[model samples]
Target: MEKVSFVIDDALAFIVRAPLVTPFRISTGQHDELENVFIRLHASDGACGFGEAAVATHITGETVAETLENLQSAASALRGRRITDPAAVCREFAPAFADNHAALAALEMALLDLSSRVQGIPLYRLFTPIAGQPRLTFKTDITVVIGSVEEARATARRFAQRGFDSFKIKIGKDEEQDLQRVLAVREMAPGCTLILDANMGFSAQRMLAFLDRLDAGGARPLLLEQPVPKQDWEGLAAITAALEGSGTLVCADESVGSLASARRAVETNAVSAINIKFMKSGILEGVEIARLAAANGKRLMLGAMMESALAITASAHFAAGLGCFDFIDLDTTFFLKGDLSRSPYLDDSGRFDLTGAGSGIGVVPELP
Candidate 1:
């Protein structure tokens, strides 16, 4: 008798620059075109899986060049490894990018995808068994990029027309301007779930002051994300503590890069919730952070970088399998002018049909 080994026979990395439906502005910068890196891995039996990573220098300090370089370097070592054990796949190549989570995430996702496809199971089932569940689908919020009040209002209306009720508004440019933009959206659509993402743009004092006004108005948003800089753990804690009684809950995004960073943010009481992005924290470590969030009574926001449908769909599968995320922002694909791949899990309604069966992430990468 001979033992079979799950050997990865080949690996390839490539980049695709996807244009946004409209100019997207966060506090740190504006993006009309998003450069994304994608990976494909093949097993000895010819089974292949695809993964994606989007670079945002402000969030992950990774550019298209760096992501591809890191992916290529890691892919070289991964080509000949047996991936029956997924954790080992991460351990082998994660070091290529000590601080480059986006690149590492792409590699980790590809390996996970490849392994599951060989076994002919959806990607999430690899993390946890989905033996008995009502359904696996999830609803996600749409993001409204930083813009004028009217522009924000129009964007809100557009998504709402598409049957979306949750919206994440990008802020951190100007305090007053940001507030007015939120108010504009709120006034236009009072019943929608509103999330304000500062993207680490506000000063501690300014953030606190603005929250105070929102609280007084009795319309503080459902959440505030990375109000201050990522390094300002004390500031994050102060804001979270201040909003304890009855105000917008604070969530950390940029502050969480890996399992250590996510754990530290929770230990320091930085925020009430943590935004877990696969691009900022690869799937392997991101799951650990999700466990951390669950144990600490911290809320989870399953988010994504500016990648296409493939990456966001992978993130969604993880979220559905975990069954613990309180919020979902896997809406980056909603803005993509064209999908690098098609995701069967997602529909125009911004929902994931997790019950849909197949192999891997239920995505087919369409590269030009």
Candidate 2:
């Protein structure tokens, strides 16, 4: 076997604005572009690795500027040090900068990438216990932005024709409008898996009413995501209870960020499922959250934060390795203006091909 060789020497981050295919809106806010931060780490052995993060003002209220500052402070500790234990590097930094999740995510990703390169294996191989065969690809669900009934139908039809079997519809603008959006998509693709993302815009009563309307209309959604505000655990639990046995799963999105939040959600039974994102939970923390969710008998799904290929691929590898995600929302690369990495692109079926050439985030492209 080849010997492992890696010593941290330099770390840097750069900003890029990746335009979206369409304006994505939720209850909190919307954006037409992703303010992304790209991280690069150089080792003493003349090898390098890459990581990226998408800073969202509405979700985490973290901007590229803020993430950059935190990245500088967080990554500085790794310089002149040899990274023999990537996971330990992340675990050690967890408590000091618990608030800087996006920064921590980027930094953790860089360390994992560096580790993968040194070991001459894929990033997921370094994950928990390592999968027996190391699954390297996964299908992603395409998201339909909040829009009129016609736009919803059009979006569903477009992706359906491209062989996508799952579609996530953005809702929560208004009760009646939200109902119509779901109906439009269901009518267009009745066989496809459907997810309605409210982004914490609904009240408990409103959620129940909408579920009633959905039942009346025969449009069974795969799940309802973040129907109430993040802090209102009572409301989330109420909605989840109301929808129990109704075939519609309630998923927690914003309520889960760090392990603390994940534990609270699990202990309180806030929802039947969770939408895990590396943007909120760092690479290490995200996996831990998934383990916690599974242990609690809660279904798990994976999502992204307007990331480019580097970050999206990293996340896909994480979820695919664990092999437990029931839903996937890592299709941000479909909205990106250009490819950030080679062959991390999704297939025609909307599945990410994580088995790409090169190591360390799979061959970074020419910085698009």
Candidate 3:
């Protein structure tokens, strides 16, 4: 790798707690507010870039305080280092920061953003010489968090009226209630495709039974995501095998967080699709996993935690740059109380147009 003529001079970390517009509930718990760590890295040439880490205690097992400490420790190690290659930097730091993947991911984002800015190119351009498209457009699915049946219907109707054609329903709390919520959403938005995400709440048998019930009710979802726990590889494999010719995709989200896990998922045929989230694997590993999944014919879904526009925009650039993702679920920013950050993308209905983005993820934070 050719060495870049820039040295990291300083690093700063900020803790931002933003309230969600509404409670975002999954099988694990509910989140009314999200705490995120933002890292700003300065280069020797007076250029700087930003990165964000959404601290999910249940998902990453790192609280905001722990992530802050981790980021500070990483910043010290990153000082005075020349960024010859951002991916190499990420790999080199992976072992030292193995306990905090989200922290390392934030650092990787800042490094990539800084490097791309230094080169006077969009962040996505650093990954691919040819642009994904002149406009970098992609459609995103809006999520309807776990709620009452009426709430789900109202949410679906509102988003459908706004032009969203896809809905990801959070389920797995009560199979019967979950079925009702799905039916409610489908009734409100009859033509929209449904993606059911249990977030590792159900067992293999329970999920299979639920699928049978759904089929009986004549309500078919396009995807079933993480119906079983993350460690239940056999359960995942069983579900995948059960859905062999059903035209329904079984996706592994929490199960496939890293390259090793993704390889195992592919080898064992645990699921047909893998969800790519930078918070889980960091930017470099996420990209590597995406390539691995694609090469093995596993479908790709780009997703995120409850992040602000900073990380969401970075993810958008990643997805648009690679152009390999089959589904985009980067709509977490909409749950924020207000605009926590700015992106170069224009949202029309569920589609994003990144024609207005400048270099380095094209995201500017509106500090809270």
lDDT scores in order:
0.80, 0.79, 0.85
In model 2, which regions exceed 4 Å deviation?
A: 1-5, 129-134, 341-345, 355-358, 363-368
What's the best-to-worst order under lDDT? 3, 1, 2
Which should have the higher lDDT, number 1 or number 3?
3
lDDT of 1 by residue, 25-133 (tens): 8988877877888888888898887878778886566788888988887778778878667667677777766778788888878877777787777877776522234
The candidate maximizing lDDT is 3
Leading candidate by TM-score: 3
TM-score, one value per model: 0.94, 0.93, 0.95
Candidate 2 local distance difference test against the native = 0.79
Which stretches in model 1 have alpha-carbon errors above 4 Å? 1-5, 129-135, 216-218
Q: Which stretches of candidate 3 lie over 4 Å from their true place?
A: 1-3, 129-135, 366-368
1-368 in candidate 3: lDDT tens per residue? 23456789998888988888899999898788978999988899998889998888877687888888988888888888887877778788888668788888898998889888888777876664222443278888999998899899899999999999999999988778899999988888898888999999999999999989888877788898999999999999999999998988999999988999999999999999999999898888887898889889999899999888889888888887888888899888778876673445847486777766677877766434
Q: What is the lDDT of residue 6 in candidate 2?
A: 72
lDDT of 3: 0.85
Clashes of each: 0, 0, 0
Per-residue error for 271 in candidate 3, Å, reads 0.6
